[model samples]
Target: METAGLVLAAGEGKRYGMPKALAKHGDRLLVQHAAETLRAAGCERRIVVLGAAADEVRAAAPDLPETVVNPDWATGMASSLKAGLAALAGTPAIAAVILLVDMPGVTAEAVRRILGHAARDALVMGGYGDRRGHPVLLGRDHWDGVARTATGDRGARDYLRTHDVRVVPVGDVADDHDIDTR
Candidate 1:
């Protein structure tokens, strides 16, 4: 079962000032970093969801893997997550490791740990001690439910909350801190 990587890079970054995808985290843009992190973690297929200055992000990071533009991105994160999952519908991926672009601290090791639980019915996420965080692995079996309840900024939180989720501890291997401000 191939686990695809889904990078949600559509946020406008109202708090950080600028599109989060365009934000630089070292030499590469946040979108590039997120996608590269997934690739390094052994995800053979990677898709990036772009919005809120999609053209600029595409121009800035021309090397990004297959990208899907979310027309309703201004609504919230849910749109981007839905767009990314819709793009994955045609692939052979059994699960997707979801990552947020602004989360520059999320490392490949953390994603790899989540990938270990990939399956058609698996719902797993990385845990930092007692706290759960990204990247969340959503199996194909739960995609419909996730998409249904993913409204506004909730994303898959509503669905995951009601389902059996496995939280993999990865604080020692990665950081889940998001770059919310400059």
Candidate 2:
């Protein structure tokens, strides 16, 4: 099955005083880093969800893959997730590996590890020892349920909690530390 990559980079980053997608990591913007990470991880297709400073992000990262702007981004991360998933609905991909733009520590290797569990019925997440984290793999079968439960920054947490989610330990190759501040 073809697994697509969904980058959720629409947050306004209230804590950081700017949009996290525009934040710089090394020489690349966080959103660029996110899309590149997914590409390096071998996702057959990639889509970025932009919000807040959508025009600025587009102008800054002109080479990014397909992008969808979430009109309700001010609401929360859930809106971005919904937008990304909705954009992927027409694709041939059977699953999507979800990543957050602010998480610079989640490397391509970690995403590749999660991609191994991609399936129409799969619900997998990366685990850091005992703590579950980003790069969650959501199969096509659960997209509807995830979209339904995704609301007010919860994203897919509510749906994952009620389902059987396979956790793959990727701490050895990646870190889940998110850049929430300057």
Candidate 3:
């Protein structure tokens, strides 16, 4: 499966009081870490969505495969989802795209496993130890459902909450967390 990397770096990190994507968790900036990890994990195509701090994030990874801007990002994660999906729609070779960004701790191996288990007709998401979180992998066939998420404050969460997604129990706690908010 040709998996693409979709890093949602557009979030303004309202609670973090800065651009969370740039928030450094270690040697590499958060966004860079996510991008480098995805790129290293064999993602043939990579798309990073940038909004509020677009220029900053874009500059962070100038060698990125593709970068799309979500002008409606202020509206929320749905907009970022729409923007990223729109950019990826043309790549038929793409089986699924893994969403990664500014989160503090997912290792590259975790993404490899998630991409390996991605079901053609479903989304991959589940609990991160004690919490439900991201790095959700949505197959190309399910793009429409995820795209329909353009009207809300999330990135396919509302629909995912109701539908049957292939829950990938992240064995690694780091791969299943959202660092900006908590």
Candidate 4:
């Protein structure tokens, strides 16, 4: 099955003091790192959602994958997630693996593992050891509802809570920590 990669990079990052997408992880910008990880995972197409400092981010990573600006980004993550999903409309992608811009610990391996578990009717959640986390795989079947439920900083969390999500262990290949806090 075909899958696309959605990198959520539209947050204001008030907690991190600036746009987390521009934050550096080692030598690469956070957005660049996230986008590269998604590409390395074999996503047929990658969509990045930018809000805060969108122009600066674009300039910083000129080679970044297809990107869209979320004008309602200040509203929260939901808008960005929705924007990313909308950008995938009418595509051949049977699923989308979501990656957060601030999460540098997520590896291509983890994303591939999640992609490997894609089902037309199921949601796959990447797990680090016993903890479920990012690089989530949302089957096309769940996209509409997931987008509808995405609100605030919740994204699909509310929908996932009310549904059955398959967890795939990927700790050996990735870390599930968020670089949001200073």
Candidate 5:
């Protein structure tokens, strides 16, 4: 299926004391890493939602991909998610792999695994052992409902809780840890 990469990097990172999207994981910025991972995993197009430090993040990773600033980002992740989804509205992609900039541990292989199992009628999540996490694949068929229920820091989480999500264990291929705190 044709899939797009949606990176939610607009958070102010209140706890981290800075924009987490600009946080460095070795040589690459967190947002850059996430976008690159998505590209490597086969996203036809990559769209990033920037808010906290939009210009700085863009300057740091100019070639990342298409980016949009979430004016309502102060509200939370839901806004960023909505912005990214909106950016993908007119694309040829049949689905999108949702990624968080704070998740530097997520690797391209994990994304590939998740994409490999995606279906138009189902939700696909990367599982780290017993816990399902990032790189959530939302088929076009379910986008509207997901967007409707997404709010605050709970982007798509509530919707997924009420749906049957297909999990692909990727513990060995990637880490599911989120760098939300110091």
Candidate 6:
């Protein structure tokens, strides 16, 4: 099975006073941490959905698998997601494993686990303590649905509600941790 990794690094980080992707957490930027986690999970192809400080954030991951700039990032996470989905449109054999640049707490093991079961449904998310969060895995079948997502506060949660999901529960704390300071 083919799989692709997508990182959402387009946020303006209004509350963090800088691009969220460039924020420092530990010794690395949040987006770098996230991209590293995804890359470690054995994803052959990677894509970054960038906006705001697109150039700066893209440059941060010089060896990143690939990069896709999301000009509609001003619209919000939904736009970034759709942008990533569009980039994956040509790769029908690969699943898109998405990560949030701000949520650096999500571990690589969790992402591997999610990808391990991607074929179960169109969408598979890492669940922790009753809440499912990112590093969400989407099989090739859902690419069209995700790419067609509309503007104004759209996201995978709404689409998942209409389909069956393979929810993998994690006993870890990353599920409840909200990285956004705002």
TM-score of each: 0.98, 0.99, 0.86, 0.96, 0.96, 0.90
| True lDDT of residue 28, candidate 1 | 90
- Candidate 3 vs. true structure, TM-score: 0.86
**Best model per lDDT:** 2
- Report RMSD for candidate 4: 1.1
* lDDT string, candidate 4, 57-126, tens digits: 9998898989999999999999998999899888988888999998888999999888988876879998
TM-score of candidate 1 on Cα atoms, chains taken together: 0.98
Off by over 4 Å in 6: 173-176
lDDT of 5 by residue, 1-182 (tens): 58888999998999999999889988989988998999998886999999988999989888889899999999999988888888888887788899999988899999999888766676999888789998799998888898899999999999999999999998898988899776
For model 2, state the Cα shift of residue 28 in Å: 0.8
| C-alpha local distance difference test of each model | 0.93, 0.94, 0.72, 0.90, 0.89, 0.77
Candidate 1 per-residue C-alpha lDDT over 20-91 given as tens digits, one digit per residue, 9 for 90 to 100: 899888999999999999999999899999989999999999999999999999999999999999998888
Clashes of each: 0, 0, 0, 0, 0, 0
lDDT of 2 by residue, 13-35 (tens): 99999999999889989999999
Q: Candidate 6 on 111-157: residue-level lDDT in tens?
A: 88887876624588888766677768888778777666545545677
* Positional deviation of residue 91's Cα in model 5 after best superposition, in angstroms: 0.9
TM value for model 2: 0.99
| TM-score, structure 6 vs. true | 0.90
- Candidate 3 regions with alpha-carbon error over 4 angstroms: 126-131, 173-175
Ranking by lDDT: 2, 1, 4, 5, 6, 3
Q: How many backbone clashes does candidate 5 have?
A: 0
